[model samples]
Target: MTNTENQARPIFPFTAIIGQEEMKLALILNVIDPKIGGVMIMGDRGTGKSTTIRAIADLLPEIEVVADDLFNSHVSDYDLMSDFVKNQINRGKELLTKWIKVPMVDLPLGATEDRLCGTIDIEKALSEGVKTFEPGLLAKANRGILYVDEVNLLDDHLVDILLDSSASGWNTVEREGISIRHPSRFVLVGSGNPEEGELRPQLLDRFGMHAEIRTVKEPSLRVRIVEQRSDFDKNPEACIDKFREQQIKLKENILLAQSKLPNVIIDYSLRVKISEICSILNVDGLRGDIVTNRAAKAFAAYQGREEVTLNDIKTIITLCLRHRLRKDPLDTIDSGSKVDRVVGEVIGDV
Candidate 1:
């Protein structure tokens, strides 16, 4: 497709989305601080999981990247640059740059290891003595968002590969004796229906946060959602125009949060209580505590605050700890509620 045709494709505006506030908050926090890892969204089918994810990509401001780079390598940030780009920079080459919309790559369930991780042409290497490496989805996903729909249905091994690359911020493909490594940093967002299946806890815990959404129950709200969707389908341009102001404001807010995140501070006592809840819940590892702190700070930054408050932690604590709790097949309590209960006992009522 031509660039114009691609750009012309209409998307539902993020601000126009009516419900699923938890999912939206999780996505925005991850965007503000990707080091919180990524978010895993579990919800009923048709809960706007995919729609909200796509809208987030559209809502984000354009990013500057190296022109003609396969990995969308940032022109200036060394950590976001690919190996090839870094080499060119090290050699003092003048790099051309351009601004483009943030990339959002969908990981297909049927993708093979090589297709996800790129490949090397060993034949060319042995005969012509040149390593010809083909870039894959991970390459394309660098410095953007990698979304996996129906993530629970994805093969466990493939999920492992994804989690590894996301955690390490790099992807390496090896063929024979040739190995090629490139930056694969991106926020990994996965959504799946709980009725279909659940991700293995080990893999799921690697996700920074988890947001559970249900289909809207209020009749009036449901009607509003339906009407908004219908309007978008009939006249996308008009629907987009309707939300233009809100969209711009939200985009600016997200950009401002990203810039202010480093300055947002969570108090020592708040950190202690965060871990205390995790410990009481018998959560595995330190991920729960660490993510909760990071998410709280991100939320504070999003709210244009420099100091993280108890309300900030309370707002995001459940999302940070819900999935990390050990599952008891016989326990009937909702994980989110259980988290709230523990938070209440440890931190006192918010």
Candidate 2:
């Protein structure tokens, strides 16, 4: 199939969809701050996982990027490599520029190991190529999002490669008689059903937060959803007009949240409360605490608040750290209940 054929496939818009407010909020939170690592949406198939992500790709504001920079590296960045690009840029080079909304690049399950990292051009090298470098999925995903559907089913080696690249912000390739390394930094987004299989603990830990998305059950809401989806399928132009107003509102909310994140402060007592809560529940590592704190601030920012209160922390603690906590076979406290217990005690203490 041609690239034209592939691009013709329809994408669902984020704001046009109905219900699933929690999932929408979580995704928006990560978008406001990519430092949230990325989000993991775990649930049954056909739950609009891919749809929501693709919609977000379209909804995001266009980012300003460097001129012809591999990895779509941001123009705002200094300290770039590429002696050629760097020298030209330093010499006061103006850009051949275009604005692009963030790309949501997919990683298909069937992708080969070499295809992902890229391979050496043997024919080109032997001819006039002089070992010409080619781009890979990681290259396309930079300054954007790398989405893996059914991520739990991905090959072990591929999972390892992604985890390493995610941590270091670059992928190193030394294969096929060539040594190539490039920046591949991105927000790693993955969605899968937990029943099919579990992602490796190490890979799972890379995700900053996890959220559950279930099918909406309201009859009126469900009917509206189907009608809107049908309308979108028929005359996307009409559906777009109906949804764009909501989209603009959401986009404004996201921008407000981002701007508010820097000034939103968490009290010291609340910090101790969070640490104590995570400790009581035996959550592993410091990332949980850090993410919970940030999420609380983001939540407050979303609410147009200037500071994070204990209530804000309570609401976000589970959303942030629940996935990272260890489960007990003997004890019956589920992640949600565990969070509630901790929140209650912490609030009492504070």
Among these predictions, the greatest lDDT belongs to: 1
Task: Write one digit per residue (lDDT tens) for candidate 2, span 1-350.
Answer: 88867774555779877777666777887787777777778887777888888888788778776668766765656432333456667899876656787878899999887777777777888888587567688777877888999988999798778767766777777866677777777778888987787676656766878787777777898789788878888987777787788888888888888888899888898898889888887887887888888788888898899888887876667777766764442332133776777678767544
Span of 10 residues, lowest total lDDT, candidate 2: 326-335
Off by over 4 Å in 2: 1-10, 79-84, 176-179, 327-335, 348-350
Q: Which regions of candidate 1 fall more than 4 Å away from where they truly are?
A: 1-7, 121-130, 328-333
Please, what are the lDDT tens digits per residue for candidate 1 over residues 36-64?
99999998888889999999998998889
Q: For each predicted model, how many residue pairs clash, with residues at least 3 apart or on different chains?
A: 0, 0
Candidate 2 displacement at residue 159 in angstroms = 2.1
Cα lDDT for residue 42, candidate 1: 90
lDDT for every model? 0.90, 0.76
Alpha-carbon deviation at 230 in model 1, angstroms = 0.6
lDDT of predicted model 1: 0.90
Candidate of highest TM-score: 1
